[model samples]
Structure formats: C-alpha cells, structure tokens
Target: MTTLLEPVLSVRQVLTLERVLAGEPEVVAGAGQLDRPVRWVHVAEAADVGVMLSGGEMVLTTGVLLAGDDELQAEYIRSLHRAEAAAVVLGLGRAFPAPPDVMRRAAERCGLPMVVLHRPFPFAELTEEVQSRLVRRKFAAVSLSEAVRTALTGLITADAPLQRLLDEIAQHSGCPVVVTNLAHRVLATAGERPAVDDVLRDWERISRQAGRGEGDGWIRAELGGRGERWGGILLCGYRGDAATGRLLADRAAEALVLHRMLGGGSAHSWEEQSAQSLLTDLIGGVVPARQLLPRARAAGLPVNRRTFVPLVVRDGDPGRLDRILRLLGMPGLVAELTGRSTAVLLSLARDQDAEALAAHFAARLRTETAPGTVVAAADGRIAWDDVPAGLREAQHVAEAVADSAAVLDLPPVVRLRDVHLRGLIRLLRDDPQVQSFAERELHGLLREADEDLLSVLRTYLATGRNKSRTAQLHHVSRPALYRRLEAIRTRLGVDLDDFEQAASVHIALLAHDAQQR
Candidate 1:
C-alpha cells in the first residue's frame, strides 16, 4: 500500500499487470517474478524493439516481429535483458492464435518476465492506466515534500526545543533523529522507540559511519544556513524509501537551524547561551533546586541519582574540553566563565568519588592546556540540591589558585582544603582591609627598585626559601640570589629566617596577585 505522502515509482510487476489488464494477462514465463521498479510502458513492432527501451519498461507487443525463428527470438530476449526491460506483454489473436514457443523459451532462458494477453485487449488502455498512476504518484511526492516543510516550519514558530522538533520528525519518518556538532558529539537526540540511550550509547561509532553508506541504515542532512555550516542531522533506522528519508532529514535540519537562530542572541550560539545561563543561575542561587532540576535534566545531565562534581579550569581550551567530554561519553555542562577560565559540572554515578573523578579530569586537561594551568574542584561531591554551593566553592578555589604561587605544586586537583592560607587570603582579596594590608606590607617592593628582587622574593617564598633553586631559576649565583632576597626582606621589613614574617609576606603576595587577577 502506498500513502499519499510516500514516495512513488512507475515500476510494474507481473501481478500488477494481471490486475491492470483485468485477469486477461497471464504470466507464461518467468512466472515467479513481480518485484522491481518499472520505468515506463512502451510499445514497438520492430524486430529490434529492445534497443528502443532505456530500462525497466514493460514492452507491449504482438510478437509479429519476434516470431518464427527460435534463434532470432532468443536473441531478442537476450537484447531485452541487456537493455534491462521490466517485462514483455504479448497480445494474442491476430499476430498469433497461441503464444509462440520460441519467444516463451527465450523469455524463460533470459529470465525476462513474459506475460501473454489471452483475451482481446487494447495496448492503449494499459499504457494510459499505468502512465496516469505514475503521474499522480509523482505529484503526490511533491505535495508530501511541501507538507513536511510546512509542518517543520510551523513547529519552529512554536519555539519548540531541539529535542521536540526531532521527535516530531522521527514520528513522521519512523526512525531515530540525532543532532550532533561537527566533532560528532551528540548534542540532542529524539525518536528512538526503545529508548534514546540505546541510540546514543554508541553514538561515537554510529556518528562516525553515518551518511557514508546504506548498511548502517543512516542518512544525514547538513544543518546550517547563512553561509556557515554548523553540523548535521542524522536519521537512524530509516525504513522509508531513500527519497522520503532525505526529505525528513532535510526538513529536520532546516527546523533545527531556524530554532537555533530564533532562540539564541546575535552574539552567542544557542548552545553556549543555554550552558552559560544554567551554570550562571546555578551559582547565583536565587532559583530553587527543584525548579532548576528539570532544566538540568533537559540539558542532558543525569542529575536524579548521580553526584554533582563542580570543576573550574584555567588556561585550557574550552572547545577541546568539550570535545574530550563528548569523546569520553561523559555527561556534563561546560561553559567559559571568563576569558581565561572554564567552568564545568560533571555528573557521576552514585558510587563514584568526586576526588578521584576530579583527578582524572584534571590530568586529562593538563596535557592540553598551557603550562602553569590550574584545575580546581570542589572538595567533595554533593547532592543535587547543593550543587550551586559546590560550583561556587570550586570557582573560589580556581580564583584562589590562578596566577598564585600555589599552582607551582601543580597538584592534579586543587581543592579548597588544599590551598590552605593562600586560598583564604584569595577569598578575602576584595576586602578593603586585606587590600590595605597587602599595600602596606609590600609598599617598598612596589616602589621603583629593581623588579628582580620582587621576582626572587616571589620564587623564594614559593619554593619554601630554597636559595639554590631560586638562584638557578634566576640564572644567578647564590650570592646574587642572597643579595636579592636580603633586599626583599629589607623592603618588607621582614626576616627571611623568621617563619611568622615569611608567612605574612606570603599571604600578602597571594592577596596582591588575586586582587590583580
């Protein structure tokens, strides 16, 4: 059965020929064949009629030119096979009272469908009926294409989310719909009848092979407009005809591009805005956890039964982090918090420890980020309701460690508990009293003296007063380094050998740097 919205073709089978000719047509040879598309209905009386057909055409003839010579008839059938005709319908009576044996044997030998008209039938009637049906089907296909475009456009105007739009397309096409970035990360998915997880569980491999071949049962359409390509929309397990699958994928892509444009502002992509908004609101803490839970889940976080681990990374590529997350199949939200910082919220299984996960995450990012990059995470995992606090805590640690002597240790995961006194000083960096204390303690160093003394002081304090390392770092002799250190102590009115004075100087330096950042 063919619906008005389904693709149409003009291929005729032997069964269809019998039906069209009102049971007068009988399959005399190649009787068990009825499947394959027909191109057109053709009629010719010449001996070399096979040369006239392009392919897949049902040739209606009287066998007047193909009669008598068994060898000639066999050659004619072979020529039809070479030309790829659909079937041969021979009319009986005037040309031959009975079906010709030579043509019947030739048709069977060549495996060409041979149908004989046992009763008187006009060739014109058969041609007219088949041609009209083909025309109607072609027009129906056009109408269906337009209808899909209209439906998808209407959904776009409704401000439906990306997943909802994909769902509708899946319903129409009876397949799964997947939206992916150019890096092949599954951004959103819909229309998997069993479950979306089933489709996405192996998305990395599935997306790699998508649109390259038919064995994968996938089709793709480019998903961008305005002279820029964003990504692609994939149709998985599309059982419909190839033409209809293309139509469905293209319509879905158009709707997605339109949805992104309408939902996003001029400056940021819709995905980026969605990530930033959710993260910003989470840390802002005005909205209730229950209210925000739905949004988090909709954004693809497994928030219900999972632990929330908040992380902040500095000096790393946010794009590369995003791609790695997708490659590892980790469910998380990553967004740029500042030009030099990126914030992340990772969802881990209930049994997983946040410390271990943070270490792994930081280690992976360390290889890709610039040297001296700092990755700070919350001290421990928290429940979903406390995620905002967790995010703020990680952000505080990241701020505390950025450009500070603490990052010299390069711990895999810097935590609030790990930064010690420096973290506390950084946390209080904005206080008027703390700013005054730093300015007072380091006023002499801040004065126009050789800046090398300040560098030596910063490095010497960072390395726990290791004079040899400090000298080697500054490419100077031990006395030269000692001279710089003595100058720093004199400027700050502190003793390098006194632990209390050294600690005060360290805290002031940390506060000064945090405030600058």
Candidate 2:
C-alpha cells in the first residue's frame, strides 16, 4: 500500500506568498531542501522552541533573545533539526543585524532550510496567512475525497461496469488509470486513447521499475482486502502535488476494492472480462485490427511478427484453457464468446509450429475435459488484418461440429477441412434459400413435432444411413430401427432406398441443426 501523505504547503510555496515576500526573505542554508512540506507555521522567540514544536512546522522568530549566546544559537538550530521542523525563519534585526553564521552553519550541516528576513515584517500576519491557506487547502482536499467517493459509490449502486469506474477515476485524476494483476498484466485502462496507448506500450518496463514508494508522477495503491494483495491501480503521469496524487490514488483504490467485492468478481474474472471485450471488438471488425495492436501488447500478448492461430472451443472452460496455456508457456488470449463456445487466440513466434502447438493445446484440453470436446481452428494467419476472418471461420467450424461430435470421428483439433460439408452448411444456414429448403424438406416431420422420430432421423442421417450402427448407438433392435426409419421416410414422403433423396434430407437436416445452434 502506498502511504497517503496529508495535503500540505511546501516551504518553497510558503516563501513565495505575498506576505512572506514583503519581508525579503533570503535562504541562508539548506537551499536544496526548499521543497520540504510545511504542515503549519509557529512564531516563537524561545531558545528551546524546538521542545514545543512538532515535525513539518515552519518556525518563525527573531534573534532578540539569543543575540549574545553562540552556543544557544547553534543549539537552537540543532533542536529544530532533532524536532524535525520543516524550516526556520529568523528576522535580521535588534540583537543581530546579519545572518548568524553559527546558526547558518548548524542548519546547513543538518540540511534544515534556514531563511533570514532582510526587512522587518509582522510574524502574526505571515502566520495568519499561512494558517488560513492551509485550512482551506485541507478542506478542499477533504471535499475532493468525498466527491470522488460519492461518485464511485453512486456508480457502484447503479451497477456500472468496471470500465465505467476506471473512466470515472481517469476523469478525476486527469491521467491514465491502469489496473493490473499481481503478474503486472494490464487488465483494464481508461484515459485518452493516445496516452493510454503510450503507457501500455512501455507497461512492462514501467511496472517493473515502479517501487513501493511514489515517484515520477506515478502513484500506486494496492487493490486487495482481508490481508491478501492481488493487484494494484496506478495513476500514471498525474500532474499534481504528491499529497493530492496520493489522496486520489487511495480513494480510487478503496472504490475499486469495494466495487469488486460488491460485484462478487475475482481479479481473474476482471481479466477475463477485459479479454472478452477486446476479442469481441476484434471479431466485430468495427475497429481496425491495427488500432488494437497496442491493447494486445499491453495485455501481455505477443503480436509482433508472430503467427496468429484462432481457435474456438465448444464447451471449453476458459479458466482451464488459460491455465493450460500458462503451464505450456504459450502466449494467448482466452474468452468465452456468445453461447457455449470459448475463443482462444494463440500468438506463436514465426519459428514455432502453430499446428503442433494448437494440437497440443487441444490434447491437453481433452485430457482436462471430455475426449469428444471439439476445438475448431482456422489456418494460421500471419497478418493481423486476417484475424477477424480467422475467428469467424473457427466459430463456424465449431458450430458445424457442435451437434455431431458424438457420432463423427474428429481429431483433437478439428479444422475447417475436418468440418467439410457441415462447415459449408453452417456458413449458408442464414441464406434465405437454404432456410426455405431446410424447412420445406423437413416440413412433414416439423409439423408432426415427434421428438422420437426427429432424434431417430438425426442419428440415422448423421451416421451416413448406417442402420446397424445407428440402431446400436440408439440402443434399439434392428427391426425397431427399420420401423422408425420407415416412419421417418413416410412422414417426409421420401423413398427409403432413394440415394439422392436421402442425401438431400441429410443436407437439410445439417442446415436445420446449424441454424438452430
């Protein structure tokens, strides 16, 4: 967890104020430490004022009480140092006219900023001005915190998606907001497209170099609860004070954790959602594939000069498939598309064998799932523009074999060639002529609404009209199977022994099933 620093004015900012500038304040020591945050201002003339002070307070005083005591002057600076004061402001008048070397040297050695007022100025006025500004700043910070919290809470109540929450944070921070899992894989991003792309382009390097402490305008807050750290949210290139940035990051983190808990989604589920959105857009083709390349790279996918293999697995568990990919050290994106099909895109180096890797993935899936699981894949595509077509082809192949996987002898990885006629029927299922033909050929059986006969016909047609095999698989006697086949033929008004008619009925049945799936 990143530490949340309270909103405060820095010593440099305080010195630049109108009231402080009227006194012609000059830095006598610790010039490099002007950026130290000043929590408050205190006016004191006591030599032992440090005992009454706390850290982050700018001490204001004159040399009226310590003009003749060299030891006390040096000790005063040391006391403030030990007390962790932000800086010391002294008026050069009365007891001493010039900056005290004893105190300046002491402050320089301790690295405590020391300033001397060349002209007389009222300490009360400077203190009052600084205090009022500090109070207003603190109030504004609190207001900002509540405003962000309220906005995020309202979004959660309205059931807004994770992306919406990220966008809200980005709007408030005015910078790119990135959410990543413990492995540093970017799950989601929200901001200007170009800025987000730039951050993602160098995400790996940046994430690796980011420390637990904030720096370089990057503030990170861990996203987790109940003593478990799963991921983090980063505010990249936030052009605000460190304190303000910390506040924004901490608020955003709290909101994100609450959103996840309320939605009942694990961090891994968010990753899956991210993959689903990306893949859906890619397959939709509304956005050009080139525009999505940076997102792909940011999501930890290898897309440069790689062979892209698109696969659609019917009834495959996405979590299991992802684990298998990781176990095999393969780079891929897995997401559940519409229906029971899940899409997996493999990005293999050009030198690697895409076919062998896809086959191995299918084999592992079968071992983990069912032996008859159909993994429909398209031919390897080298160009990104060809990915949309590849995904569509794979999906068509999966749907083509979805219903017939039980009877058909399919390889572990089924390709378009393996789907053959079924694949062609799936592609044409939406054609008006094909739909009318399927309905006309099967009109009699469709009107009857006899599921028993429909099942018998589907099995018989799927088995290439092999009577004995269909009967055995359906657990029926040959005589009974013949009776069912005759009933189907009579209902459809087709000759039982006609080769061309049976082939036509089989094609119609394939088309009908494809349309239904």
Model 1 TM-score, 2 decimals: 0.50
Q: Note the residue pairs that clash in candidate 1.
A: 11-38
Over the stretch 2-92, how does candidate 1's per-residue lDDT look in tens digits? 4434443433343465545573777788765545456578887777877787777888888777667777777777778888887888888
lDDT, each prediction: 0.74, 0.89
Separately for all candidates shown, the number of backbone clashes (residues 3 or more apart, or on different chains) is 1, 0
C-alpha lDDT of residue 303 in model 2:
83
Give model 2's clash tally. 0
TM-score of each predicted structure versus truth: 0.50, 0.88
Q: Which residue pairs clash in candidate 2?
A: none
- Indicate which candidate wins on lDDT: 2
Q: Give the alpha carbon lDDT tens digit for every residue of 1-517 in model 2.
A: 1125456888999999998999999999999999898888999889999899768999999978888899999999999999999999999888779999999999999999999999999999999999998878778888888999999999999989899999999999999999989987889999998999898878767787654554568888899999999999999999877788889999999988998899847899989988887888888889888888878887888888999999999999999999999999999999999999999999999999999999998888888898778899999999988998899889888989898788888888888889889888888999999999999999888754677888888888788788998998899999999999889988899985788998899899899888887
lDDT of 1: 0.74
How much does candidate 2 score in TM-score? 0.88
